[model samples]
Target: MPYLNITEVESGVTSLAAAFPATDLIELPEPTFEGRTCHALRIGTHRLEPKPAVVLIGGAHAREWGSCEILVNLAADLLHAHAGGTGLAYGGTSFTSAQVRAIMEKLDVVVFPLVNPDGRHYSQTVDPMWRRNRNPAQSGGNPAAVGVDLNRNYDHLFDYRTAFHPSAPVQVSDNPANPDQVYQGPEPFSEPEPRNVRWLLDHFVRTRWFVDVHSYTQKMLYVWGDDHNQSVDPAKNFRNPLFDGKRGLKDGLLYAEFIEKGDADDSAVLAERFCEALKGVRGKKYSPEPGFDLYPTCGTSDDYTYARHIVSGQEEEKILAFTVEWGMDFHPPWAEMEKIVLDVDAGLVQFCLTALA
Candidate 1:
């Protein structure tokens, strides 16, 4: 199956859903600007009420075709394993059928295999470098300049004031009209793509973990993408105390404190486990670090999901969010895609196992 286009992705998802009747294939509330349906393949149910849920999202950036394939294949593997009543082997570890069923029974696994359908279609058919959704409204009605980096369109820590770093030689754009890289929309959750993602996270109250899959970097990234310091001590790192009152600097400080003293250690441990499983296949290495370690980014889905728990003050239900960067380039060669998908699938399986463990 060709993984470069949205049609193939949709077909694969449909086939999987047909094969696994238990899987719920849900279309997002709204379609992309190009009228392409964005589907979320949900495995398992919420009837158990508040089960630990893990959401795996891919194709956020249109050009990263490999990410979508990895997610689809992973979902298929799980469904096939359940259907055949067979165990799954990964990272030299085998999961028994009972264990697999336990995971399915206890966790609500939601996979948005292709988050940006319009962009995927555009990249596969038109430009292979398209990185955003085809939302012409954001481009002053100019079709050529229509695209919002969905990765930077999430709601949490979305204020451009905190995210925008004017001093950095390379920075995300505040102006949508500029039409350079990293054009965050006029406001947070401004685009339908991100709104769909937010809708999923909000509707699924049991989502305790999230993984936003992307490609070419081969890294496992944790939250707080706006800050580069891996070990940012909240006490000394928070410079803006009263910049915009309680909802502004105060909230930011509290977020930083949670990062430093509460979530960082556990998040790093989960990332390390994921990287270890990934390396087990073909000896591929993946660096495990904070998201900003690669570069400062804001409005990212992973960070937003992580912040959801922090902001809610739900310590017990804190969502462990991550961004898994696959392969070494945005568009890796077709011949190399199998190994890439297998490696990521193994890592993701291990991640789910860890969550259930």
Candidate 2:
């Protein structure tokens, strides 16, 4: 059975701790965010050897089990690769067990697989597809049930898209104050989970490839989502069945190829690169376009991470910050979910190797 409880997660952490000094559990204090405190189990790399660090995160949204599942799978792989040797070309790349172990020696891997544990707990006990921290205020007379949508609550583009897009593709919601969904809270970092995430990243993750995993999409998402401009969106632009064509315009269509990790690209660059990469694979079914179809939602962690780690700093080379939407969150049948999980895991691993490696 899949591990579903915090107790199980704790056991996983403990196992890592016993095996390597690289692993440690981090707790997020309460009241800062209405959800359960998150934990970051860091896998250390030997000091003499230097390898790229990757931060894996999941459970930002309650129903998105695929994210955490992938994270857990990767964790298991790392442990196995460390203990023995297994990662081979069956994965399509030259990632051997020895190489994985060597990579572990040089690289530090940190993961916070469960970001909104309270919300996830509620999802398990209450609604299987629940998305948001459990605030539980809404009742007979309650006006709203808006709990902070961790996916929407990041510090970057903190715009409240739910407020504007009442009829968005994803209809899942609760009263803003309901604490069940769509509640961004009084401000960004208002919730403990997010605050702790910010605190940890700010203090610990100096420079790294940070991925905030989400689910239910066939494609991997990169950056620049708040604006909703069709042109200035990510690779997803090509995925749009309605996308017109690549206008040979570098403005927003295909610009990611030019980005040099820490190139300090603006929202424009991020979106451009994302769309450009997708355009190549979309084939004739989809075409690259301009303008962000997605509106400008602020306080988004992707935007925040991009700005802080890639856009602003000069000391570090470049940090690739990404918001990976695995797939739609509400697909029925467990088998379908398993397929998506595999695709997402495999595709993302390839993407990381190609994009960040």
Best by lDDT: 1
Give the TM-score (vs. native) of candidate 1: 0.88
Q: What tens-digit string does per-residue lDDT give for candidate 2 at 183-262?
A: 55555666667776676676454446667777544333444443333333344322232322322122343222122323
Instruction: lDDT for model 1, please.
Output: 0.77
Relative to the unseen true structure, what is the C-alpha lDDT of residue 234 in candidate 1, on a scale of 0 to 100? 43
Error of 2 at 256 (Å): 14
**Every model's Cα RMSD, please?**
3.9, 8.0
Best by TM-score: 1
Question: What TM-score does structure 2 among the candidates reach?
Answer: 0.70
List candidate 1 segments past 4 Å from native. Answer: 45-49, 90-94, 141-144, 162-165, 177-180, 228-262
lDDT: worst 10-residue window of model 2: 282-291
| lDDT of prediction 2 | 0.53
Root mean square deviation (Cα) for candidate 2: 8.0
- Model 2 bad stretches (over 4 Å): 29-35, 47-52, 88-94, 136-146, 159-180, 228-296, 309-318, 328-332, 351-356
